[model samples]
Structures are given as structure tokens and as C-alpha cells.
Target chain A: MAYRENEAEAHDEEHHEHHIMSPKVLIGTWLGLMVLTGLTVGAIKVDFGAQANLIVAMAIAGAKAMLVCLIFMHLWFDQKYNVMIFFGSVIFVVLFISITFIDTKRNEPFRDAYDATNKPTPEGRVLVEPTVSPISTSGSDAAAQPGELKVPEHQKPKVPWPSQLPDTPRVAPTAH
Target chain B: MSEAAIDADAAHEDDDHGHHDEPFLGHHFKDHDHQFNTGKLGIWLFLGQELLFFGGLFCAYAIYRGMHPEIFVEGHHFLDVNLGAINTCVLLFSSLTAAWSVRMAQLGNKKGLMLMIALTIACAFGFLGIKYIEYSHKFHEGILWGQLFAPSPEAMEHAMHGVEANSRLHIFFSIYFVMTGLHGIHVIGGIIAYAWLLKRAAAGHFGPNYYGPVDFIALYWHLVDLVWIFLFPLLYLIH
Candidate 1:
């Protein structure tokens, strides 16, 4: 046991010098992350177009992820092979998702159906095909009323959808 | 021993004696640099797989959100922004401390490593605590996934400000639960991993030449933070 203790002490004496980041870097990274998070919250208050907002949020998120990877994860100082492995996986994921979306976007009938039902307007959405008066907010029972087709008073669409008008002439050849 | 064999052993000893006698460096490794590089490559591959694992869910989220953008805007309101932001900060702070621990281990500062590990573990628990609060609120409000989603009357009133009751709202919550739940599991994994590393650190198993565990675990912790970095804005701050 004494000999083992002596060995341990000797091991301790043989100091191994390596790279050590100053505390300033850690603090700076932490502060930067916190500020970016604050920015995310703040950006939501501004009424950018929905797509723009999504893009902005995602951009901020991507930036934060990069910081974590490069600094906190030390990918900046890590081997080139490791970086290559990481980006390769990211590329595969993006490819998989993009391919799936390309297919999903191509299907016309389903896309139109989804749009008509789930997203009735560019400004407002009508997710459910309500049978009853939307003004009646008592409960689900009020939603059971049929034939009226009353749009909810609170969620009224900003502009009437062209599809909802019977008087408008159909431009498609099939309509004639 | 045969004379030639004895000579070979002597030569091997001579070759290794002046070089790093890093205790953790395996016999098969040629040198410290070789061992570190191999371990680093393995960790990066592991991290890459982790990205793909979460990528599948992110793809699903993107596709569904594209299909029904309105549901996300409505569903996000049910999530508290302050709680999510706080959690994000907590996780970010934990990541910093985790990175610091690796640095400390690299510099042979055992005390600093132990302290940083403790701080990281504490921040992780703090994140979970906030998450629990947010989840319990959602549970009570009946904002749940799939068939179980029965938004309360109050929630319905708020969401219906300019839209009808969204039937597909359940899908949003499903994504929310799955993504965040997976992230939470990662946080727990980080906590357990850090605790183990802390024990090892206390036992003086790490130093400049052999701080592999500390470094690898820091990378894992950063990935956990990275996932949350996306989840926070996507799930909570959506307009």
C-alpha cells in the first residue's frame, strides 16, 4: 500500500502541460449566449411576416448552436477529421429531410386539401370544419350545431377567401 | 527468456521510457497523441450520430409545421416563454462550466475540475426543475400530445383570438413533447455522466495527458445545450 501511495505521488509530480483556455473565454461565451437568448425573446415581439419570423428564429438558433460547437465543444481546436465527420452527418440529415419535403411538396391533391382545411387563409387559420356558430363559446356542444357555417366572431378572417365566393367566375377550363 | 526476446523487451522499454507514461494510455496506442486522436474521432462520430437521431425529429417538426403553420403559432402560446428562456440560460451556463471542467482537467487543476463539475451538475438540476414546473403547468392545463390533448376552456379562448379551434394543435404538442422530452433525457444523461466524471476527478484519475473523459463529456454536454438552443425558440418563441 505504501509503495502504491508512493507511485501515486510520483505520478502526480509528473505534470502534463496542455492547453488551458482563460476564464475570460468561458465568461464571454456564457454572456454572449445569454444575450442571444434575450434577443430571441425580443425578436418575437416584432411582427415580421410569419415566414420571416421563422427564418429569423432559426438563424439565431443556428448561430447559438455554432458557438456551442466551436467554443464549448472545442470543435474549433479539435482534429480536422472530427469536424469532417460532424459536417458529414449534418449533410446527411439535411439531405434526408429535404428529400422528404421535395416529395411531400410535390403531392398536389393532398397539398390542396391540407391548405383548404388546415390553413384557410394567409392571415388567419381555420383548422376545424365547424358545423355550428363560432360565436357560441359555451362548449363543444355548441360546436355540434349544423348547417349554419358561422365563422368564429373572434377569429374572423381579414380578407374573404376567393374560394368561398360563389359569384366569382372560375378561371380554370374545367369550371366552364 | 531467450536472449533475442530479452533484447526486444529492452528495446521496447527504451522506446517508451522517455515518452509520456500516461496511466490511462492503453498499451496498444503508439503514443499520447495517437490515443487522444483516436478517442476524439470516436466521440465526434458519436456526436454525429446524436445529431442524426435528433435530426429525424426536427425533420418531422419542419414538415408538419409547413403543413399547418397556424397550429404552431396557436400552440406556442400555451408554452411559457420565460420558463423556456430561463431553462436555456441554465443549460448554457452548465455548458460553460462543463467546458471549464475540461480545461481545468487539462491544466491539472483537480480542485477547479471538481468545482466546475459540481456547478455543472447543479445547473442541470436547475434546468430540470424549471422544466418540471413548465410541464406540470401544461399537464394541468391539458395541453398534451395526440389523443390526450384536450386544451382547457381558457387555453381555447386564448388560442381562438383570430382562429378557430385547431384540430391539428395536438400534432404541435406531440412534437413539442417528443423533442423537449428527448432533450430532457439528454440533460439527465449529462448529469449522470458528469457525476461519474466528478467521482473520477475526485479520485485523481484525470490530468493534462489523460483528460479524455472530461473532454468527451464536455462535448456531449455542449450538444445537449445545442439541442436546447434550437428547442427554446422553435417551441416557445414562435410567432
Candidate 2:
């Protein structure tokens, strides 16, 4: 037992040293991370047009995450197997997001149809299709005009409110 | 007190076989490198799984944010950017110290290792402290998750300012709570791990031949920071 122990101890002494990441490298990585963080925050201020802004922010963040993985986590110098494992997770995450987006897009037309069927139109009031022309409501006009309260064209008393039509009895359609 | 006594002391020291008595080395491993390398591989696998776990949440955030882009744009205004930035710095600095601790252990600088571990723990606590303030502010403002969401006057004002106060705004706060809450739990776990490492370091269990625990824990700490690196921009830096 003593002899075996001495051999193991000799092995331990022989392999005691490891690749110690230098303090300079670590501090440099931290500085790089901080700078990337600042860039992300600053990118938000740049008018990158809505979608582009989000893209830029995500890009900066991705850069920061990569730095942490490569330097601080030691994957840059560590075994290739470990890097493979980490990137595998990242790749799976991207796949998950991509699948979800595809499904959402696939169902979008059905969602629009559902909305059209369920949307309620008030009695006697045709839903005005939106137009490029400016729509000024008489209410705002009346509020603005102190002396004259001109009735809006839609609210004129000459138009009769639509009376409720009698409920028509109908047979239920048979299932084919 | 005589010359013979000194000679006997020297003879005893020689008989002990200096640097060969490592009580910490387990019998199964051939040497320290084998044990350390094995531990490192195991930790990498565990960290990979951790990434997958959090990846699910990130996917959820992505889907919802894509669906209700306006909700996120409006809801993010409630979160204070300065606090998030400060916490990010704290976690990054802690990661630095955590990495340093591993180096110290490898160099057999017990004092430096212990001090770095302690600093890492302190920084972890500071992170939780800031997170607590942020969470409480959210709670007090009634920006809660799901059914518990009751927007305070301030939150209501912000919501009314845009997107017509869709109840789906609750989804943003829900994601916020779930993601940051999980990360907070990770931070707490990190604190506990660092504290345990500090005790072991104080007991002189770690050194050049057996610093696997320090290295593994530092790797874990860096992962926590890495996750936050993404979370900070996604949640708090919304344009």
C-alpha cells in the first residue's frame, strides 16, 4: 500500500500544474464584456428602424455571450468536446425558436379568418373601411367651434335608426 | 537542544517522503490530473444541460415577444435600465474574481484563493440584493405575472401611453419574473456553492494537485454571467 501510494503521489506532483488563465487575459475579457454591454445599451439609442434595432441589440448580446463562453468559461483553450456540447445546446435553442416561428406563420391566415367572422358590426352602422383621407369627427369640430354646433352627417335626424328585424325561424343543417 | 537532536529531526523529515502524503486523493483515480479532468468533463456536461434548461425559457420569450412586440416595447419601460446595468457589472466582476480563484487554487495560493472565493460570494450577494430591489419595485408597482397582474397607477399610465393596455401585457411580466426568477435561483445556488468552496479552501483542502472544485465552480459562475449577458439586453435594453 505504501509503495502504491508513493507512486500515486509522484504522479500527482508531476501533473500538479494546469493551464492557469492569466489575470491579464481575464481582465481583458471582462473589459471586452463591459464594452460590448455598453454597445448594446448605446445601440438602443440609434434609430435602427424598429426591427433593425432589435436585431442590433441581439447581435451585440450574442457577441457578449460568445466572449464569456470563449474566454471566461475557457472553451477557447479547453477541450473541443466541451465546446461541442455548449454549441449543441445553442443550436438546439435556435431550432426551437425557428420551429415556433414557422408554426405561428402557418396559422396566421386562419387567425385572420376567425377575426373576420367574430368581429361584431353595430346595428345600422356600416363598419367604415379605413382610408387614407383624414377623418375629422363632428364631436371634435363641435368642441372646437364655440358658437355653431353643426350636426355630423352621420348623426343627422333625417336618417332612421335601423329597426331590429324579426327573427327568422330556420331548420338546422344536417351533418353530412 | 544538541546537534544530535537536530540531526534526528532532519532524519525524521527525510523518512516521511515529502510531497507524497495527499489525504485528499481518492483511491479510484490514478492521479490528480485524472480526477481533475474527469470532474471538468462532468461539469461541462452539466453546464450544457443547464443551457438547454434556460434555452426553453428563452424560446418562450422569443415566441411571445414576436407575437406581441408592442407589449414588450411598452412593458420594458417599467424596468429601470440603470439597475440592470449595475447588476450586470456586478455579475461580470464576480465572474472575474471567480476565475481568479481557480487560478489561485492552481497556483496553491491558499490565501488568494480564499479571498477570491469570499469576494465572489460577496458579489453574488450584492447581485441578489439588487435583484431583490428590482423585484420588489415591480411587485409594489403591481406589475405582477398572469392573473396576479394589477397595474399600479404608474404601470397603467405607461400601458395607456401605448398598445391600448392589452391584457397580454401580463405575458411580459410573466416572462420577466420567470426568467429573472430562475436566474436568481441560479445566483442563490452560486452563492451556496461559493460559500462551500470558501470553507473547503479555509480548511486547506484545495491546492495545485486538487483544485477541481474551484475550477468547476468558477465555470458555473461564468455561465451564470453568460446567461445574464443575454438577459440584460433582451429584457432591459428594449428600444
Candidate 3:
């Protein structure tokens, strides 16, 4: 063990240069993340339309994630291979999401027809032709202009089952 | 440089076999640097795999949101943005402490390392505590996933003030619970890791040449924070 220790010490002397991140950088990263969080929340108030809002929110989140990775996780000072591995995973994620989205988009019409025809009414009544387009993306506009989108009556479910039914089953006599 | 010297060194190494100078150094490793580098590589690979694991859920989220924008518009109203924002800040602060703990371990500051680890654990618990509040409120309101979703009248009345409730609001809640619940589980895992780290740190197991575990765990914690960074905007601050 003594000889092994000496050998280990010799190796350490030759190849022991680890980076220790400074507290200043860590604190700064935290602050940046917090500010980005605030911006994401704040951006929701401004009317950027649905798509633009999503883009802005995602952009801010991406920035915050980058800060966490580069500073807190030390990817900036890490080996190039580690960076490659991380980005490779991110690339795969993009591929997975985008490919799945393309497929979903292709089959959207079939899904819409199925949902329109199969959706059960709150009252258990027969399905009705949807008064409004189920796949409408203008939800904010619909909300703003309330009269433009007719509020569906089925949104509110009538509860409390009637106590007496006309077709109730009668009890049978028991054998002696 | 002679064969005789090499033989004598091997004999001396065998004589000292039972008494290791650095007990923490694995016997299989040639040196601390070698062990640290190998462990670092292993951890980076694990982290990459973890990203792919989470990417599956993110894909599901994008698909769902794209299909039903109204559901997200209505469902997000029920989530407390303030609580989610607070949790985000809590995780970010924990990440900071986690990184600081690695630095402390590298500098051989045992007390500082322990303190940072404890802070990180506390912040994780605090984040979970906030999540518990949000989840319990939803549970009480019957805001659940799939067939179990039966939002109470009061909840609907409160949540759907001016907007109409989509029939597929349950899908939104389903995504919400799955994404955030998985994140919560990860936070629990981080707490457990930090607790173990704290115990080892107390025993002086980490120092300048042996802080690999500390660095690896901090890298993991930052990834957790990274996930939440996206989750906060996607789940809570939906436009």
C-alpha cells in the first residue's frame, strides 16, 4: 500500500489539475436564472399571440438552462467530449419531438373526426355535431370575443340522479 | 531503470498490500486522477442517458399542447404560478449550493461542504413542500388525470371564470402530474444523494483529490434545475 500510495502521489503530481468554479460565477448564474424566470412569467401578460408567446417563453427557459449547465454543471470548463455527449442528447430530443409532431399533424384530421363523433355528452345523450370547431387554435381570440365562440352547453354537467325511475326492476320472492 | 529495481519495487508494493495509504482510492485504480477521470466519464454518459429519458416526456408535452391549446389555456389557470415560481427559485438556489459544495470539497473545506450539502437538502425539501401544497389542492379539487378527473363544481367555477372548459382538460392535468411528479421524484433522489454526501463529508472522505462524487452529484442536481427551468414556463406560465 505504501508503494501504491507513492505511485498514486506521483500520478497526482503529474495530472491533477481540476477546475474549481468561483462563487462569484455561481451567484451570478443564479441571479441570471432568477431574472429569466421573472421574464418568462412577465411575458405572459403581454399579448404576443399564442405561438410567439410560446417561442419567447421557450427562449427564456433555454437561456436559463444554458446558465445552469455552463456555470453550475461546469460544462464550460469541461472536456469537449462531455460537451459533445450532452449536445448529442439534446439533438436526439429535438429529433424525437419533431418527428412525433409530424406524425401527429398528419393524422390530425382522423383524430378530430373520431373525437367529434365519439365524445359523450355530459347528460349521456346522443352525440351532437359540435357547434364550434373542436380544433380551433384561436382560443385567446375566442375568449376575448366571447360571442364569436358559442359556449357549449355541455360544459356544465347536470348532477343528482333522479331517485325514482319508471323502469325500475322489482325484487323477486325468495324460496322457502 | 534496471530490471532489478523494477523487481524490488514490485516486492515492496506487495509488502505494503494490506495497508493502503489512501483508503478511499479503489484498489483497481492506478491513481486518484485515473479514478476521477473514469468516474467523470461514466457520470457524463449517465447524464446523457437521463436527458433522453426526460426527452420522451417533453415530446409528449409538445404533442399534447399542440393538439389542444384550449385545454392548456384553461388548465394553467388552476396551477398557482406564484408557487411554481417560488419552487423554481428554490431549485436554482439549491443548484447554487450544490455547485458551491463541490468547490468546498475540492478545497478540502469539510465544514463548508457539509453546510452546502445541508442547504441543498433543505432547499429540495422546501421545493417538495411547495409541490405538496399544489398537488394536494389539485387532489382535493378532483383535478386528476384520465378517468379519475372529476373537477368539483367549486373548482370549475373558480378556475373557469370567463373561459370555457374543454372536455380534454384532463389531458392537460395528466401531462402536468406526470411531468411534475417525475421531477418531484428526481428531487427526492437528489435529497437522498445529498444526505449520503453529507454523511461521507462529515467523516472526511472528500478532499482536493477525492471530490469526484461531489462534482458528479452537483452535475446531476443542475440537470434537475434545468428541467424545472423549462417546466415552469411550459406548465405554469402557459400563455
Candidate 4:
């Protein structure tokens, strides 16, 4: 019992040396966090453009994140290296975003090239419901009603397109 | 054998134990403030690096988002705002308790310190529980991540409830899962840390002048909570 009591007295004597932060800062931080939380939820109702919407939401989230880090997490009281850690994270984020965007840009050229290779060759025609009319009906009554008309030129292109439209007029011409 | 010698031996044992326990202490330190400062600086450095690590993930999110804002929003619709808001509240409050625990430790209030630490752990568990609920909801909706990721009807229902919705929306869920999952993992780590600290604190290992462990842990727990603050808004609060 004496041992425990002595330990307690040691703790009490030690407590006389340090200074805790004021209650005002704590209350202010709490209030600020609640307000930001409400705003984040509120922003959902306002539909900005796709990109702007994300930007606004993220900006608010960042602010809230800062509050938690600076105030609640006590980065406010820490040494210089603590600041270094935070900034280092920010630099990494920049690198991650840059790399990802760079890759996206890189993929764009490849996508175009891929599309070029698989473009429709017009080599052959599989008979189907044509997309556009091939012949003119200047003096004939053979033309069907517009609603029920079938066009030959505008056919839905074939599967497995092998190449681009071949460089010449190879198909026989239809007299208009 | 005699009472006088037995008393002398007990005093000697205490002196030896106290000296051996303070190896990291310095001459300038009366109560281990030097060790505390070193440990605090170390934690802050670790936290700074962690911030950057998570920052990298956020940057990835930004790129994907920039490339496909519509897709991102489509996924955002799946998140439950009400639940997210509540979780934010829980985490923010947990941070408060963590702060209080450190304060109690500094005051050498063992009972108060233990209670606050326990409170913080409970808050972490609560955060985890809520996270599980959110994740299970995603699972039920068929929403997932990576190549196997899919959209839940609820997610889709929430997502395109009012937009030019399409199948491309699944990608949004993909980012959401990656970001939130990583955050969830951090919350788990903090919970384990809290438990260890709580045990030590309850055993009265800390006094007013030697509570660096509690401060560092609180700093970490706050960061964990802080990360969620950003996550909640990004994931759940977009139209």
C-alpha cells in the first residue's frame, strides 16, 4: 500500500511542471469540424460540372483533413521534421498524379494506333438490311416508301475489320 | 533475515529498477522529456511519410477522377451520406478522446488516462464496425474493386439517381474501394496500437513527465481519423 501511495505522490509532483493546451482551441476545432462535415454533405445537392464537382468536393475534404491534422493531431506543436513528413506526402501525391496522367496520355496514342489497325477495309459486303440507298429514282416508281426503305450503302459494317478502306475504287459502280 | 535488512533490500530493488528503465533518458531530462521528444519527433516523421504515402493514393484518385469525373460521381452516388456523416462524427469524437487521454497522461491521472484510452479504442472499434457495414453493403450491391469490381444496384441506384448514368460507373466504385479500404486498414492498425497503450497506461507505467508514448499514439490516432475526414467527403459527398 505504501508503495502504491508513494507512486501516486510522485505522479502528483510531476504534474506541476507541464502546461496543457487551452480549452478554447479544443472547442473551436470541434465546432469547425462539425461545420465542415455539414458542408461536405451539403455540397452533394449542388450538381456542378463533372470535373468541378469533384474539385469542390475534394477541396473541402482537404480543408477538413487539414483541420484534423493541424488541430486534433497536434502537428501545431511538433518539430520541423513533422512538417517534412507532411510535405513529403504531398510530393508523393504529386508524383502519383503526374504518373497516372502521363500514362493516360501515353495510352491515348496507342488507342488511336489500335483503332487505325482495325479500321473497316470495305473488302467485301455481307448482305443485310442496307443503311442507305444506292440507286436514284429520277423517273421510276420502283422506290419504296421512305418509312419502309432499305439503303445499300449504309450497311452496319462487318465484324473483324482487317484494314482501312483500300486505296482505290475496286468495286463496280452502280449507275445512278 | 532481519526487518532492517529486508527494508534495505526493497529500497535497493526500486532504485535499480528505476535506473535501468530510463536508458533513453538524458542528463538534461529530469523526467524523460528528452526521450519523449525523440519519440515524438520520430512519430511525426513517420506520420509525415505516411501522409505522403496516402497522398500518392490520393493523387492516383485525382488522375482517375480527372480522366473520368462522371464515372467517379457515378460511383459516389453509391455511398451513403447519412452513414458517412455519422462515421465522421464518431471518428472526430474519437480524436477528442485520444487528445484527452494524452492530457490525462500528462497530468498523471492514471484512471482518467485509462478511461480516455479505452474510450478511444471503443471509438476505433465503432469506426471499424461502421466500415464493415458500409463494405458489406457494397458487397451486397455487387460493387467491388479492381478487375472483378462490379456495381451494386443500390450503388447504381444511388449513383445515377440523377445524372447521365452508364455502365462506366463501375470504375467509380473501383476508386472508392481502393481509397476507403486503405483507410480502413489504417483504422485497424490504430485500434491495435490503442489496445497496447491502454494496457501500459492502466498498469501506471506513465507519469506526468514520461507520457511521450501516449502523445505519439494520440498523434497517430488523430491522423487515422484525419484521413477519414478527407475520405468521407470525397467518397460520399458528391452529387
Candidate 5:
């Protein structure tokens, strides 16, 4: 019991080293984040060209993210391992994004070609045919008027139907 | 030894080890520091995974924007920048309170911790409320994703001013809804976490020696804020 009490006292002494962020730092970080937020919003007003504007917005956002991770999340006062883990994840994310961008950039020509060849229907133009059945099988004269299928020009099937295909020669029967 | 004798010995051993005395400390951990460090490491790993999860959406946004910069240029005009900015401020304030709550827990100030936690919860709800307004406005305007991308005539006028609506505008809204929807889900998760913390705190469950839960949840709340830090600029402030 006495030994446990002594250990507890030592633990108490060690506990003082545990870092607790000050309110001053927290408030300052908050204020900085707010100012950065304002800057991001305000940046949209200026004509920095599209790419330059995106870069400026991202830069400010990156700063705010750093502040949140370092201070709000206490990575600054945290163990080195924690910091490494967080940053390693960020690096992986960057790699993932960049690789995806590279792949997409390489495929841009294909995508453009596809888009050009198969243009989507114009706005408010529904390409799907109405759901009601258009064919009639009754022998009556009026029923002989097979309903015309209003298939969209682009959506019409390219291959002929089985009934429309040329007949093939019959094979000889095989011995059982 | 007999069973009763073994049980007695185990009880005495626990008494000597002082595990029972510290109700909050886990029996398996060597000490408070061990438990706290382990919990912190676990949360950090989860956060790392979370980054990658959100990273996928960001990659989609990058690819789509790269291909259709015009869509983004037109799409962003439909989003309410003022509401987005207000929500950003709200989240930032909530993050401050969350961090402060951790400090409060560390300092063993129950009232301060409770106050900060409550404030953080309030701010989170405020953010979601503003988000609700934005989403409803979009829904009403028919500015939606995929096949549902038919913008009302007025919405089209508002978005384009005079330019024709891009057919691929739905792609932008798709990215927008997926990203913001995921973030809003995280906010809801944070609210649930904070509520749990609040309940434990009301029962006087946290203090300097056992504030790991508070700290872990605060880290999570900050991460949600971190995601929004990038999201606000990417989705709302597009050029």
C-alpha cells in the first residue's frame, strides 16, 4: 500500500508536464481562422483569373487547416508519433489526388471524344420513350396499324433483331 | 490454494494495485498515461483514415473541375456564399469551444468543461441549421444532382445571368452534395459525441486524470472543422 502511494505521488509530479493549451492561444487561433475565412470569401470578388483565384483560396484554407490541426487538435504539444501519423495521412491524400488528376488528364482526349460523339439530350428533352405498349396483335383492321416506336435517333439500336436476320442452313442430325 | 483463498488474494492484489481506487482508469492499462496515450493514438489513426475517405471526394472534385471548369464557374454562382461563410464561422467557433473544453477537462474545471461543451453543441446545431437553409433553397430551386439536374427557369437565370446552362452542371452539384452531405454527417456524429461527453461530464466522470474521452472527441470535432476549412473554399468560393 505504501509503495502504491509513493508511485501515485510520482505520477502526480509527472502529470504536471502534461500540456494543456492556454485559452489565449485557442482564442488567437480562432480569430486567425475567422480572418482567413473572410479572406477566402473576399477573394472571390477579385479577378485573379480562375486558376490564380483557386490557388489563393486553397492557400488560405491550407493555413487554416494547419492552425486547426496544430493548435485545436493539439498536435503541436502532442507526441511526435501522432504528428507523423497525421502528416503521413496527408501525404497519402496528396498522392491519391495527384495520381487521379494525372490519370484523368491523360484520359481527357478520350472523354472529349466520347462527349462529342454521344452528346446528351438537350435540356427538358426526355429521351426515354413513353411506357405504354405501342404494338397490337388483334386481327382487326384497326389493330393492323402497328404503333410506331418513337425511338430517339441517337438511342436506336445498331444491331438487327433476330427476326430480321438472314436464315441459316439446318445441320444434319447426329447419331445418339 | 482453495478458490475462496484465491479470490481473497486477487481482491487484496487489486486493492494494493489501486486500480479500483481510480474508477475511470481501465484495469488493463498500467496507468492513466498509458490509457490516455493509447486512446490518443487510436483516435489519430481513425482521423488518418478519415482524411483518406474525404480525399476520395476531393479527388473527384479535382478531376471534374479540371475537365469542366465552366461548370464550376457557373455552378458556384448558385451557392449562397453568405450562408456558407456564416457556417464556416460557426464551425470555427465550435472548434474553439471544443478545444477549450479539453483544456477545461484537463484543468478539472467541471463547470467550464460543461459550458464549453454546451456552447460547442449549440454552434454545431447552428451550422447545421444554416446548412439546412442552403440545402432547402437548392432543393426548391431544382438545382440537384444527376438526372435531377433540371434547374428552374428562374434558377437558371440566376445561375447564368444570360449564359446557357451547361449540360454537365449536374456533375458539379453531384460533387457539391456528396462533399457537403458527408461533412454534415460528420457534424451530426460530432453532436452525438458531444452529447455523450456532456452526459458523462454531468455525472462528474472527467477530470485531469481521466479526460481521454473528452480529448479524443475534441480531436474529432477539430477534424470535422478541418474538413470544412478546405470544403468552404472549394465548393462555395469557386472562381
Candidate 6:
């Protein structure tokens, strides 16, 4: 037991000395990170159009982030469990974004068609288009304008009140 | 120390062969080397998880950039490249101090360790001060995100004065703020950890034989510096 214990202590001391990252490697990572940052910033300006720009910028950013994690964070030297946890979190984020984008873009068409079929008509349940008449009285323009407002007096809109002339093709504005 | 903290003699489920009688060995570990390996491994794993957290933010930036490429290009014009580069240089200096601190600890040089750690902490504060200046400038520019808030147009006008881009540029700022802010939090955390270790180092809690904490903390601080290395370009450089 004593022998085992002494051996463990010696091993412990050796372990402590072995794991510290060398300063040379440390300097290398620093330079790498600096260059990577410069490149990513430079790339943002090139017009890879819309989609292409996003991908390229992110890929570079990911690579840079990885360098920090691997070299400075010691992820490159760490335990499997830690790597697993990190990867798991990343996966969750991906799933969330995918689900939300899909739900927004895919369900749009059916919603528009459904809204159109439910449109209201004045005469019948199934909703038919109103007929246009030669002496249309759908509004009050003829009531107020002394003969000059006429498209012919009989053709004046017949809403009864002069103030009741609703402009065609105009929808009243609604509050947001 | 409690017996719980020293586990060498308690139970051996496997064959106890070529190893025995190791003094000052923790009870929890099978051997000193194994314990050190585990500690180093643990630190790296934690770092990986942190990287992934930032990774998600990077992914968001990509998606938004793809959707609105012009906005990113225009947003680049607003970044103060000189300031970003200076801050990056400042952080690189901090990493040097951090590495020196760990080296001092390994050599059992207490005073050198404390000074280096203090320098590191100061660098972190310096980085933060630069960050504050940048954010306030943004406040002056009417530049901000559209998530649960729109930056008051008045302030944004000052920060992004003379800049021409769609309102979508605000999204770019949003990602910028979140990513940089998170990185700042890590820097703060690293400083605090270093401060605590600095005290222990002063009291001789670490030496040539027990420098794991110092090494790991330095490693963590270096990672913070590493993140800034990339941020400087992505945020400040226009071309």
C-alpha cells in the first residue's frame, strides 16, 4: 500500500508538469487567431450576393471560434464528456432554427387561399358578384352635385345621403 | 485534508500492480499523472462547450447575412477599424501575460506570478473599456437591433452618421452586440478566476508540483484572447 501511494504521488507531480501548454504553441495560436479575424472581416465586403455571403462569413467565423476552443480553451486536450456536451448544445440550436424557418415558409400558401374563399358577398350565401346597372345608385354623387356632378343624373349612386359616397377601390385605413 | 480528498488507499477494483506508495496523491485519483490528465481534459471540454455557445451565435449571423447580404456590407462601413485592431492587439498582449503567469507558477515564482496575473486582469479591463467606448458610439449613431426594441433613431443617427444602408443593418449590430457581449462576460469570468488563483499562488498553493489550476486558468484566459482575435476583423474591418 505504501509503495502504491508513493508511486501515485510521483505520477501526480509528473502529470502536473506535463499538461501545461508550451509557450511556443500558445504564440502560434495567437497569430492564427489574428490572421483569421482579418480574413473574415475582409470577406464580408465581397458581394457573394446574399446567401453566399452569409455562408462564407459564418464558415470563417466558425473556423476562428474553433481555434479558440481547441487551443486556448484546451478543448483539443480535454475529456470526451465535455466535447459531447458541447456538440449536443450545438445540435439543439440547429434543430430549433430549422423547425421555425420551415413552419413560417411552408404554411403560407394554404393560409392565403383559405382567406380568399371566405370573402363575403351581399346577395347570397355562396356569394355572387353584384351586377352593374345603367342607373346605378350605389352612392350619393348625383344627390349633392347640382347636375354637373352627373355621369347623367339617373346614373348617380343612390345611397340617399350626399355624404355617403364611398370611393370605389378605396379601403379605409386600419390601425396597426 | 479529509480522507475523502485522498483516495489512494480506499478501494482498488482493478489489479494493484506496478504502482504504490505515492505520497501527496489525492485520494480521489488513481495516480498523479491520471489526475493531471483528467484535469487538462476537463478544461478543454469546458472550452469546447463555450465555443459551441458562440458557434450558435455565429450561425445566426450567417443566416441573417445570407438573407440580407447588403446590410452586412453596409454595416462594415460603420465599424471603427483602428479601434478594433488596437483592442485585438491589447488582448494579444494579455495572452502573453497569461502565459507568463502560468510559467511563473510552474517555476514556483510567486511574485512573478502575481504580477503577471495582475497585468492580465488589467488588460481585461482595458479591453472592456474599449468595448464601452464602441457601444456608446453606437448609441450615438442610431444603430441598434430590432429584437424587442428599436434603437431610438436619434442616438443611432450619431453612431452611424453618413452611413447609408437599409434598416436591416440593425440586425448586424444585434448579432455583433450579443457575440461580443458574451465574449466580454467570459473575459470577466477569466479575470475573476485568475484573481482567485493569484491569491492561492501567493500563499504557495501552487508550485512545480501543483500548478494545474494556474495552467488551466491561463489556458482559459488565452481562449478569451483568441475569441477577440477573430472579432476584431469581423466587426471592424470593412474590406
Give me the candidate number with maximum TM-score.
5
Per-residue alpha-carbon lDDT of model 1 for B1-76, expressed as tens digits?
Answer: 9999989987886786534456677767766656776787888899999999999999999899877888898888
What fraction of the true Cα-Cα contacts (under 8 Å, chains A to B) does candidate 3 also have? 0.78
TM-score of each: 0.77, 0.76, 0.81, 0.71, 0.81, 0.61
In model 3 chain B, the worst 10-residue window by lDDT is: B10-19
**Which candidate number has the best lDDT?**
5
Q: Write the per-residue lDDT of candidate 6 for residues B101-127, one digit (tens) a residue.
A: 877877888898889889988998998
Off by over 4 Å in 5: A1-17, A123-176, B1-15
**lDDT of candidate 6?**
0.64
* Chain A TM per candidate, in order of listing: 0.54, 0.56, 0.60, 0.51, 0.60, 0.52
Per-residue alpha-carbon lDDT of candidate 5 for residues B1-239, written as tens digits (9 for 90 to 100): 89999899888767766587789887777788778888999999999999999999998988888888998988899998889899999999999999999999999999999999999999999999999999999999888887777779998887789888777788889899999999999999999999999999999999988999999999999999999999989888987
Better of 4 and 6 by lDDT: 4
Better of 3 and 6 by TM-score: 3
Q: DockQ numbers for every candidate? A: 0.32, 0.28, 0.33, 0.27, 0.33, 0.13
The runs of at least 3 residues in candidate 2 whose Cα sits more than 4 Å from the true structure, single-residue gaps closed, are A1-17, A114-176, B1-20, B158-163
A1-176 in candidate 2: lDDT tens per residue?
57445535645543223778888998998899888878888889889888898899888888888888887777776656677888998898889889988787654433433333333332211232212112223454312444333344443333221121244433322210
Q: List model 3 lDDT by residue over B1-239, tens digit each.
A: 89999898778876854237888887668678768877888989999998999999999999999898989989898999999999998998999999999999999999999999999999999999999999999999898987688888889989897555886788888899999999999999999999999999999999998999999999899999889988998999877
- Residue A28, model 2: Cα distance from true site in angstroms: 0.9
Q: Write the per-residue lDDT of candidate 5 for residues A1-176, one digit (tens) a residue.
A: 56446545645543332678877898999999999898888888999998999999999999999999988887876776788999999999999999988777655544543443344553333322222212222463322444533333444335542223475533322210
User: For residue B165, what is the lDDT in candidate 6?
Assistant: 40
Docking class of 5: acceptable
Task: After the best TM-score superposition of candidate 4, give how far the Cα of residue B136 lies from its true spot, in angstroms.
Answer: 1.5
What is the Cα root-mean-square deviation between model 5 and the actual structure? 11.9
Ranking by lDDT: 5, 3, 1, 2, 4, 6
**CAPRI-style grade of the A/B interface in model 1:** acceptable
lDDT of 4 by residue, A1-176 (tens): 56345544655543322446456777688778888878767776788865676678788778877877777666655444566677677777677778888777544433333333333333322222222222323343323324323233433223312223343423322210
The list of candidate 3 runs beyond 4 A from truth reads A1-16, A123-176, B1-19
